[model samples]
Target: MADFTTVVSDAHFLEAPRWHEGRIWFSDFYGLGVSSANEDGSDLRVEAEVPGQPSGLGWLPDGRLLVVSMTDRRVLRREPDGTLVTHGDLSKHAAGPINDMSVDARGRAYVGNFGFDLMGGAPIEPTSLHRVDPDGTVTEVADGLWFPNGSAITPDGVLLVGETFGNRISAFDLTDDGRLTNHRVWASFGPLPTDRSVEVVLPALAVAPDGACLDAEGGFWIADATGSRLLRVVEGGTITDEIETGTPVYACALGGADGRTLYACAAPDFHAEPRKAATEARLLATRVAVPAA
Candidate 1:
């Protein structure tokens, strides 16, 4: 059995967890906010309210926080005075609601979208990843992703994006100006479903990679939404280790005082109405042997 402990509870579908400075920062998917807390979930504080619902969270080198406002297809920045302002408008570049994002050390953010009305039971469709500059210019840098959900940047500046519906993790080389190129399969867990309907694709995923974080061991710690586990994968599509969370884990982050703490965002289901009506989602944590990146 995998070690698991609840850091907090009664959340409205938590996702997009990040370990920043000395706290765990995360987005409450249906709660419409972003929050942070100490290592053990103490001193929990709401840092920003994203009316459209928050998905991913990242920080610029200058310490400003960048958060994804999912439904609106926009990125918001939290100013030092706590004001939330538009960082970029991605509606023009995205066909559906934007999901996970990875902001580089230079503050450039790479975001993904659903490419279809996921909650409305629309047919599953392919999507692209967009890069939002620090100054709020938007550009479609990579296309043909299958519901890109989570992402992380390697020490050498490579990007690993988890494609939930594709049953694979895609990798890219980050250009000096914040664009992605040289796309390749970083990992694959199963075959892509033949049926594109949401009914079939929803249950067909075997690995359903969602959110991810990097470790000092040069591996990825991924949340498997359908597999109910946190997977650690190395280069060449190899799963090095895994921790069964016993619940649907939608996102994860590796951070703690010593950088060995693995944080997971879990809930009973991903449906917005059910999660929004009841606060059953939680933030969970476990200790790992590898140091974080």
Candidate 2:
């Protein structure tokens, strides 16, 4: 087991962690904002406040910040002067609140969303993934995903998306025009569950793939949302390493001065009511062998 330390506490459910510009940037869902902190838990700052709730964080090539506004299904871009403006509207494509996102080198963002009322206890349904161009055009790139959540784009253009309820991570080949093709299973924990109820699916899941970050060796460090651990997974469903988080981890990111530090977003549970009612979530950090890709 690796020793974990709290980097940021009293957060209202943190998610979508990313290592950028020597800081750990993440989203606080119930806090309704995006924040960043120094790796050693110093210099905490609130970068942006999203009334609709922010879940994902990424940057454009030119250094502007892009955030996923969950409730309104919009991607808001933070101007250089610190103003937030709607970059893209995904309301027509996303079936539920938009979740995590991955911005490619060309500034194309692949966004995911919940397929149903997850916190309201509705049956789980497959959702679609959309691509938002830098010019703010929204297009559905793929559909039929089981609760599409966190995503990461490889240096070579392969996009990996975590299917939290499907027990698998799906991959797609990114075309020059920002469309996703060659859809296949990147990693599978078990057969897809036949039932859709969260209660039935939770206990049957071997690994609930959530937020993930790629390593230099092509390994993916995934937050096993249902298992309360961080798994270093290579292609073909093999787990090369694992870290016990003690709390349910929703996201993980690789970063530090040397890129060996792994950060995790954790909380007691993902229930909206409880998370919104109190601040029990934390950003935990631990050293890892592999660095960020």
Candidate 3:
């Protein structure tokens, strides 16, 4: 019965939370590393640090970590013995900084990027998405996307991606062998950006299906980075409920032994001029329905 009003603060700009090996692993974009903690946010530890800002995070099927190094446009891995190795360099394909990613059960990772230097005082453009193989080869999967961000793979092997700037989610059917096939609209956040100004559409996202160990129903939990809310989406993609907060919520994940606890990364605009981290930018948590697998 812990309501959303109970805020768990100061998670250091966390993103891409995943429940693995009895711990909640995630990234701190500005902090430039990955860390984890118990479901209760206890025993927080820095699992690994990338030289550039680390955004997306996931584990290989064998349990090695795959991280997105934003500034360097590379995918890095942490070996079993805690050694960091370059898994792949994507500088040639990524238009700007690589952002979030989702690794399939088969170990293939779908990586997204900024597409354009939105913070570089230039005209905005849509970003692109890529499929990165285990051996470090990069292939352009999709293009003409506005700030492609959070992504996830369904238990049935569908690929779900969130377009932060577009305020919608898309799903791509995965082949039996793990290749992306059919592409279609999954859901749209038409009612989001309640403010809907030119500047309010920039929120980071992390999506999970319902009946999940963390969200035991069919819906997506979205961190409304600029909206200051964590909203839940039903199977057909409807906002069933919403948790309001003072901080602009960024990305989210479900963790904890039972997978009912939700962790959110909150942060101010890292691309903002004067570049001040919002004091309200911190991690928050709450107990919720079990997550979908």
TM-score of each: 0.98, 0.99, 0.85
Q: How well does candidate 1 score on lDDT at residue 120?
A: 96
Error of 1 at 261 (Å): 0.6
Q: What is the lDDT of residue 130 in candidate 1?
A: 92
TM-score between candidate 2 and the true structure: 0.99
Model 1 misses residue 81 by how many Å? 1.1
> Over the stretch 97-204, how does candidate 1's per-residue lDDT look in tens digits?
999998988889999999999999898889899988989999999988889989998989899999999999999999898878899998988887778897888687
Tens digits of per-residue lDDT for model 2, 51-111 = 9999888999999999999999999999989999999999888999999999998899999
Positional deviation of 215 in candidate 3, in angstroms? 3.7
TM-score of 1: 0.98
| TM-score top scorer | 2
Better of 2 and 3 by lDDT: 2
Give the Cα error of residue 20 in candidate 2, in Å: 0.6
Off by over 4 Å in 2: none
lDDT of each: 0.90, 0.93, 0.70
Which 10 consecutive residues of model 2 have the lowest summed lDDT? 147-156
